[model samples]
Target: MTGFVVRRIGFYTFVAVVLAFFALPLLWLVTAPFTDTPTYEVKVPDFTPANFQAIVEHPYALGSLVNSIILAVGTAALVVLFASLAAYALSRVRLPGRDALLYALLLLSSIITGTAAMVPLFQLAVTVGLIDSQLGLILILTGGLLPAAIFMLKDFMDSTPKSYEESARVFGASPLQIVGHIVVPLVRPGLATIAVWALANVWGNFLMPYLLLSDVEKQPAAVIMYTLYTEGGQPNLRLLSTFGLLYSIPVVLMYLFVSKKYGFRFHGGIKR
Candidate 1:
C-alpha cells in the first residue's frame, strides 16, 4: 500500500510538471498579445490592444497571413488529391516490390528534405520559371509532402473492406466512381488526417517558400516572422509574440473544425 501510494504520487507529480512545461509557453502565447509590452518572462498580461494595433500598422503583417493561407490551402489540396489517388491505386493493385517501393520512396523523401535539395530545387525552379512564384512554391511543397502522405493514407485504404468496392462494381460503378463515391466516403478520416497534416506542414514551413520566393509581398507568415527581429539581431518580442499569437490561430481553428467534423480516430475505414 505504501509503495503504491508513493508511486501514484510520483506519477501525478511528473504529469503535472509535464503539463506546466507545455502550458506555460501556451499561456504566454495567449496572454502576451494583450500586454502593452510583451516580455520573455510570463506574467499577468496588462490588458491592452497596443500589440494588435502595432501589428495592423505594420505594412505586411496582415498580408503575410493571407499569403500563408493561400500557400497552405493550395499545398494541402494538391497533396491530398495526389496522395489519395496514389494510396488507392497502391492499396488495390499489387505490383512487384510494391511495399518495398513505397517504403523506399518514403525513406528517400525523409532523407532528402527541402533543405538538403534546395540548390537543385532552386536551379529547377529557375529553369521552370517558378522562382519568385507562389504557384511554384506550392508545387514544390506538394511534391515534398506527397510521399509521406500517400504512405500514411495507404493503411486506411487497406483497412477498407473490398466488399464495398466489389458491391459498387456490381452496380456498374467505374474504378474512378468507386474511388470517388465509395472509397472516399468510407475513408474520410484518412483524407481529413492527410489534409490536416499537409496544412500544418505547409503552415509552419519556412525553407521552401523562402528559397523559392523572392518578393516581399509573396512571403508567407512563417518567413515573414523572421523579419520581425531587431536590427542588432535581438528578437522583437512584442511584435514576435503578437504575430506569433495570431499566426497560430488559423491552424488551431482548422484542427478544431476538422476534429469536430470527422475526428482523427481511425476505425478500419468505418466509423464503428
Candidate 2:
C-alpha cells in the first residue's frame, strides 16, 4: 500500500512540473503582447489588444498569415493522401523486394535533412522557376515531411489485423475499393494524427521558405516572424508577443480540435 501511494504521488508531481514548464512561456508571451509599444516595452498593469491590431492591419504581416494557412493546409492534405496510399501498399502487399524497399526508405529518411539539402533545393527550384512562390515552398516541405508521415501511418496499419483486408478481398472487392472501403476507415485516427503533425511541420518551417521565397507576400508566417525579430531592430517585446500569439493561434486551434474530436494512439508496434 505504501509503495502504490508513493508511485501515485511521484506521478502527480511529474505531471505538475511538466505542465508548468510548458505553460509558463506561453503565459509570459500572452501577457507581453499587451504591453505598450514604440519602445515595445512590457508595461506592468497595462495589457491591451492594440499591438495585435497593428499586426493584423499590416499588409506584410497579414499576407504572411494567409500564406501560412494555404501552405499548411496544402501540405497536410498532400502528405496524408500520398502517405496513406504508400503506407497501405507497404503494410498489405507482398512483393519480391518489398522489405528491401522499405529498408531503403527508412535509410533515406534518416540521412536527409532540410538544412543539408537547402542549396540544391534552392537551385532546383530556381531552375524550375518555382523560386519566390508559395507553391514552391509547399512542394519542398511536402517531399521532406511525407516519408515520416508514411512511417507513422504504416505503424498504425500494421497494428490492424490482416483479416480485415482478407475479408474485403473475399467479397470481390477491387484494390481501390478495398483501400477506400476498408483500409482508410480503420486508419482514421492515424490519418488525423498525421494531418495534425504535417500541418504543424509546414507551419513552423523557416529555412526552406526563407531560401526559396524572397517575395514578402509569398512568405509564410514563420519567415515573417523571424524578419520581425532579427531585421526589424531590437526586439519590440510588445509587438513581438502580440504577433507571436496570433501566429500560434491556428496551430493551437488545430491541436485542440483534433485532440477533442479524436483520441490519438501514437505508440509503436502491433499488439497481437
Candidate 3:
C-alpha cells in the first residue's frame, strides 16, 4: 500500500511539472503583451496598452495579417477541394498500381521537402511569371500540401459506407451530386481536420513566402514577425510578444470554432 501510494504521488508530481513547463510560455504570452516592458521571463504585467498602440502604428503590421489570411484561406480551400475529389475517386475506383501510386507520391513528397525543392520551385515560379504574386504562392503551397492531404482524406473516404453512395445513385444522382450531398456531409470532420491542419501549416510557414513574395505589402505575419528586430539583430521583445499574441489569435479561434462544431472525436467515417 505504501509503495503504491508513493508511486502515485511521484506520477502526479511529474505530471504537474510537465504541465507547468508547457503552461509557462502561454502564461508569458498572455501577460507580456500587456507589460510596459516585456521580457523573456513571465511577471506581473504593468497593464499598459502601449504595445498594442505601437503595433497599430507600425506599417504593414495589420496588413500582413490580412495577407496571411488570404494565403492560408486560398491554399486550404484549394487543398480541401482537390484532395476530396482525388481521395473519393481513389477510394471508389481501383486502378492498376493505385496503392503503389499513392504510396509513391506520399514518399516523394515526404522525402523532397519544401527546403529541398525550394530552388526548383522558385525557378519554376519565375519561369511561369509567378514571382511576387500571392496567387502563385498559393498554387505552389497547395501543390506541396495536396499529396499528404489526399493520403489522409482517402482513409476517411474509404471508411465511408458505400451503401449511402449506392442509394444516392439509385435516385439518378450524378457523381458530382453524390459527392456533394452524400460524401462531403459524411466526411466533414475529416474536411475540418484537413482545413485546420492546412491553415496552421501555411500560417506558420515563413521560408516559401519570404522567398516568393518580395513586396513588403504582400508578406504574411510570419515574414513580418521576422522584421520585428532591433538594428543589431536583437529581438524587440515588446513588439515580438505583442505581435506573437495577435499572430496566434486567428489559428486559436479557428481551432476553437472547429472543435465546437465537430468535437474532434471520430470513429470510422462519422464524428463521434
Candidate 4:
C-alpha cells in the first residue's frame, strides 16, 4: 500500500510539473499581448491594448491571418481527400506484395524532412509559376503531410469491419458507394483527428512558406512572425509576443474542437 501510494504521488507530481512547464510560456504569451512596456521590458499585470491592438488593427496582420486560414483549410481538405482514397485502396484491396507496399509507405513516412527537398521544390514551384503564391504553399504543405495522414487513416479503415463492404456489395453497391456511404461515415472521427494534425502542421510551419513565398502579404502567420524577428533590424519582443499569441488562436481552437468531439479514444490498427 505504501509503495502504491508513493508511486501515485510521484506520477501526479510529474504530471503537475509538466503541465506547469507547458502552460507557463503560453500564459506569458497570452498576457504579453494585452500589455506592453515602454521598450523591450516585460510588463507584469498591466492591462493595455497596444500590443493586441497592433495586431488587430494592422493591415498586414489581417492579411497574414487570412492567408494562414486559407492555407490551413486548403491543405486540410486536400489531405483528407487524398489520404482517404489512399487509405481505402491500401486497406480494402488485396494484391501481390501488399505487405511490402505498406512497409515502403511506412518507411516513406519516416523520411520526411521539411528542408531536404527545399531547393528542388522551390525550383519546381518557380518553374511552374507558383512562387510567392498562397496556392503553392498549400500544395507543398498538403504533399508534405499526406504520408502520415494516409498511414493513420489506413489503420482506422482496417479496424472497420469488412462486412460493411460485403453487405453493400450484396445489394449491388459499387466500390464508390461502399466507400462514400459506408466507410466514410464510420471513420469521420479519425479523419477529424487527421485534419487536426495536418492543420497544425501546415499552420505552424515556417520554413516552406518562408522559402517559397517572397511576397510579404501572401505569407502565412508563421512567416509574419519570423518577419517580426528580422525585418526590424533586431529582435522586437513586443511584436513577436503579440503576433505569437494572435497566430495561435486558430490552431488552438481546432485542437479544442477535436478533443471535445473525439475524446482522444481512437481504436484502429492495420493488421497483416
What ranking emerges by TM-score with the best candidate at the front?
3, 1, 4, 2
What are the runs in model 4 whose C-alpha is more than 4 Å off? Answer: 1-20, 38-43, 230-233, 267-272
User: In terms of lDDT, which candidate is strongest?
Assistant: 3
Per-residue accuracy of model 3 over 54-117 as CA lDDT, tens digit each: 9999999999999999999999999999999999999999899999999999999999999999
lDDT of 4 by residue, 1-272 (tens): 99999999999999999998888777778777766563433447477878777767767887888898999899999999899999999887888997687777767766757788788888889899998888877888888888778887988898888887898999999988988888887788888888888888888889998888888888888878766766557756667777877788877788788788777767433222
Q: Which ten residues in a row have the lowest lDDT in candidate 1?
A: 263-272
Q: Which should have the higher TM-score, number 1 or number 3?
A: 3
Candidate 4 worst ten-residue window by lDDT: 36-45
Using all chains and alpha carbons, the TM-scores for the candidates as numbered come to 0.94, 0.84, 0.96, 0.86
Candidate 1 clashing pairs, residues 3+ apart or interchain: none
- Candidate 1: what lDDT? 0.92
Residues 1-272, model 1: lDDT tens digits: 99999999999999999999999999999888888877888889888988899999999999999999999999999999999999999999999999999999999999999999999999999999999999999999999999999999999998888998899899999999999988998888888989999999999999888888889999999999999987888988889999999999998899789878866676545544
Ranking under lDDT, best-scoring first?
3, 1, 4, 2
Score each candidate by Cα lDDT: 0.92, 0.81, 0.95, 0.81
Estimate candidate 4's RMSD in Å: 3.8
Worst 10 residues of 2 by lDDT: 36-45
Query: For candidate 4, what is the TM-score?
Result: 0.86
TM-score of 3: 0.96
Clashes of 4: 0
Candidate 2 structure quality by residue, lDDT tens digits, 1-272: 99999999999999999998888776777677776553433336266678878887777888888889999999989999999999988887788987777777767877878988888888889899998888777888889988778877888888777786789889899998977887777778888988988988888888888888888888988888876665647676655777788898898898788877774555423334
